[model samples]
Target: MSTVFLALQTNEDTRPIIEAILQDNPGAVVDEQPAMVKINADGRLVVRRETIEELIGRDYDLQELQVNMITMSGNLDQTDDEITLFWKS
Candidate 1:
C-alpha cells in the first residue's frame, strides 16, 4: 500500500484536528515541524467530523480545516461526516 498524507498548519485550532486524525487512524505517523503538522498513513487516511467535534467539544464544519491546511496527498473524498484520502490502484 502506498502512503497518503495531510498537512495542516500547527496552531491552537489545529491541535484538535491532529488529535482527531490520530485517534481515527491508528497507523498514522505524525511529523511535527515548527509551524506545521503532517500526518501520514499507509494506503488510507480519514478525518471524521464527529471525532473532531468531540475533541474540540463543539460543532465543527469540515470546511474549517481548509483554513489551516497547507497541503495534502491522495485522492480526496469529502462528505458531511468525513474526509478520506487514498491512492487508487
Candidate 2:
C-alpha cells in the first residue's frame, strides 16, 4: 500500500479514464479533491512525468489530456500510505 498524489485537470471523461486505470491496478484508492485526484495504490509507484502526454498520445490534438501540473508529495511507502493534493477548481 503506497500513496500517490496526482494533480491533473478535471473533466467528465477524465473520471472514467482514471477509473479504468485504477481498475487495472487493484488495491488502488482514488480520492477527489477540489480540483485534483488522489490515487493511493500498491506495487511500484511510478511518477510518469508525461502521464497526460502519453494518456492522450497522438490524438486529435495535444489538448485532451492537458495536465497543467503533475506532482507527487508526502510519504510513498507500502507500510504507510497517505497523500495530500492542492488545486483550484
Candidate 3:
C-alpha cells in the first residue's frame, strides 16, 4: 500500500482540524513543520464534519480544510458528512 499525505498550514485555526484528523484516523502520522503540519496515513485518511464541529463547538464545513491545505495526494471522495482520501488497491 502507498502512503497518502496532506499538508496544511500550522496555525491556531487549524488546531482543531488537526485534532479531528487525529481522532478520526488513528493511524495518521503527523509532521510538524516550521509553519505547516503534514499528516500521513497508509491507504486511507478521512475527515469528518461532525468531529470538527465537536472539536470547535460549532458547525464546520469540510471545504474549510482547503483554506489551509497546501497539498495532498490520493483519490478524494467527499460528502456532506466527510472527506476521504484513499488509494484504490
Structure candidate 2, residue pairs in collision: none
| lDDT (0 to 1) per candidate | 0.97, 0.46, 0.93
- Displacement of residue 88 (Cα, Å) in model 3 is 1.5
As a whole number from 0 to 100, the lDDT of residue 46 in candidate 3 is: 94
**C-alpha TM-scores of all predictions:** 0.98, 0.45, 0.96
Tens-place lDDT digits, model 1, residues 1-89: 99999999989999989999999999999999999999999999999999999999999999999999999999999999999999999
Over 4 Å off in model 1, which ranges? none
Candidate 2 lDDT at 78 equals 23
- Per-residue C-alpha lDDT of model 3 across residues 24-68, encoded as one tens digit per residue: 999999999999999999999999999999999998888888999
- The 10 consecutive residues of candidate 3 with the worst lDDT sum are 58-67
Clashes (backbone N, CA, C under 3 Å), per candidate, total 0, 0, 0
Query: In candidate 3, which residue ranges exceed 4 Å CA deviation?
Result: none
Winning candidate number (TM-score): 1
